[model samples]
Target: MWRESSNIGRNQTSSYYVDNTLKHSFSNKTTAKQKSNDLKMPQPDEPYYCSQQIQIPPALPDILKQFTKAAIRTQPKDVLGWSAAYFRALANGETPPVKERLEMPVATQKTDTGLTPGLLRILNKQLGPRKTVDLNIIEEKWKDLALPKEQFDELVRIGGFGGTIEWLRYFALGCSALGENITDAMKTVCEILTADPDGGPSRIPFPLFKDLYTYLAKVDGEISQEHINEVTSHLQYYVDKQEGYVQPRNFTSPDCPKLS
Candidate 1:
């Protein structure tokens, strides 16, 4: 009876030990599998897959390079905002808000009205081709530049505009808004239209100046028609001598009637 009891106890202990060993081994394997999953990268055997539908564009590299350079040159205050505008313009086949060159910082306390010569130039390049542009098109371009809606509203009200408008008149109005007075406004227009270098005389074709000036003067409602005729006539002499190019100086000089 003692020998049988000893055998029974030993068998029970052995069975317990075996069960514990198997449980421990299974727990280790489970832990190791979890750790492997945690540490291992997905798809280790094949890092890249060649899919028939996934084709890279050939011009993508150049496009990205240009975008990077534009970002650097533009130095936009709102990265995400400007990027959205840039790509949106690109997709729509409109002029992107890119500066011709990087702008140097100037120390002026004057408030920025969100319109600059460069920005205005971009708008002109975009909308100038058409003699008339729809109000919606103008709004879209304005939004692309991220200009204030209030200013646009003010301009529309100033012109008493409706669905469509003559682009030059609006452009003249834009120049008026840009400058402090009629002369200053005209100067800004000349600068924008001029092919001259920065800080140059900012000469433009006399015919264009006459048209812009005539429109501005008519809107002013203060200048006499005779005075407008007198100014254009005086500038004609210089315009002829200078290969049909009359600069801001021709009319801005004291000899000519004041634009104001």
Candidate 2:
């Protein structure tokens, strides 16, 4: 009698456990279904807004037109990235990164880096007026050009630039990095800085050339200041005849003393 009662109790306990488990599982399913229904999209019967309620900004069309024209002229490599830069500049009321005109894609391919003369000219137009520029600002501008971060870092490292850097000095260093040698670098600099028409002899003031040449030579640590002074002194006579203008021809002439 005792054994039979014990077996009956066990069966009852097992049945209760099964029932409780099924009830808990069903409760969870019910709660999950309710939550999912809460998140489900409305059916066709429900409409959030009618088409007549939609509105557009009045200036959007003109803004988009200008943006399209800029994109067409700039010919940016990364449209999405450049677009972000363009919008950010507009929002902040700052100058946007853009090329003045379209250039052959191969203009920068000479150095196999993206630092083309036209791009540099654009950068100059924006940043040249400032004597010293913030490094963070330069990095932002560099990204807008879709230039390699590594190359930017390299220039910064080579210049040993800090929070604020001299713009002309940085510009000179950029020319150095862009060219094969010091002469080539100076030539590029003159071309970029000249007031003469495009494809004409790119001449910069001799005094300005003197300053840049002296600065770059001192930075190089290869040539002595005395040697640099001597070369500039020799060029001064030629510059005198030309009303203080120095061109690549002044340095590359047959009679000109070669720089070591």
Candidate 3:
């Protein structure tokens, strides 16, 4: 009796499988019908994927920092103020000054304010010397490839990228020199803080600085510790400035009288 019951159960299972195969064949025909219906559908009165669009905040810190660096490096203090005003205007969703009147994209749009060239020159001084810098290249490459605000803001918290103590010090001094807007330098420091060969926490602190000096020293096939010392000396200047009362520290002078 048990063996007969087991055979009956197996037969039921086989019947179910055969029935499923038939159902699937019918399901494919149903899908085809659904596709045709979809093709013939009328537009809705208010067709939207979602009832409400999501709102994302702009990258305030990165925008502020990069613009500030470009401004200070390219222009005088007065112009830096104008640049700051322009940066604020953009941040607040106002039209910026124009450079031949073009539209800005939602993600990577820029207000011209007619002063971008000046700022670009300053940035170029530090990150340029491009082989063939052109208007299109500046508009497309530099503007487009700049670090997004969030990533840069993250770097400010993480010390900085490329593992260079001197670069970090440069940011510290630049921040201090900028007075109240030193947060700008902090943002810049954050953007590239982890662009080193060994990304994340595994990198040595001063690789870029030391490597740069070494590369320069070996240009004529000979290296020297003098270059290293010079780099060290410059880094020391910034370290000393931290002892003072500045909100963000400045690079210190080696010749100044020692503080008690």
Give lDDT per model, in order: 0.82, 0.84, 0.40
What is the TM-score of each predicted model, taking all chains together?
A: 0.74, 0.72, 0.19
Error of 2 at 229 (Å): 1.6
Candidate rank order under lDDT: 2, 1, 3
Give the per-residue lDDT digits (tens) of candidate 2, residues 1-260. Answer: 99999999999999999999999999999999999999998778856887789787899999999999889888888999999989898898877877777877544234677887777877787688887999898887888889888888988888899899988888888888777678877888898999999888899999899889888887888988788877898899989898889999888787776654
Model 2 RMSD in angstroms: 9.8
Clashing pairs in 3: 97-113, 155-190, 156-190, 160-193, 161-192, 161-193, 161-194, 163-205
Model 2, residue 161: displacement in angstroms?
A: 1.0
Model 2: lDDT equals 0.84
Clash statistics: count for each candidate: 0, 0, 8
Candidate 3's residue-wise lDDT over 56-119, tens digit each?
4577668767665644443342554456545655677743322222223222113222223323
- Go through the candidates in order and give the C-alpha RMSD of each one to the true structure: 4.9, 9.8, 22.5
Ranked by lDDT, the better of candidates 2 and 3 is 2
Tell me the tens digit of each residue's lDDT in model 1 across 137-171.
88887777677788788888888888988887788
The residue ranges of model 1 lying beyond 4 angstroms of the native Cα positions read 1-56, 104-111, 197-200
Candidate 3 segments exceeding 4 Å error: 1-140, 143-204, 212-227, 233-252, 255-260
Pairs of colliding residues, candidate 1: none
List ranges where model 2 is wrong by over 4 Å.
Answer: 1-62, 105-111
Clashes by residue pair, model 2: none
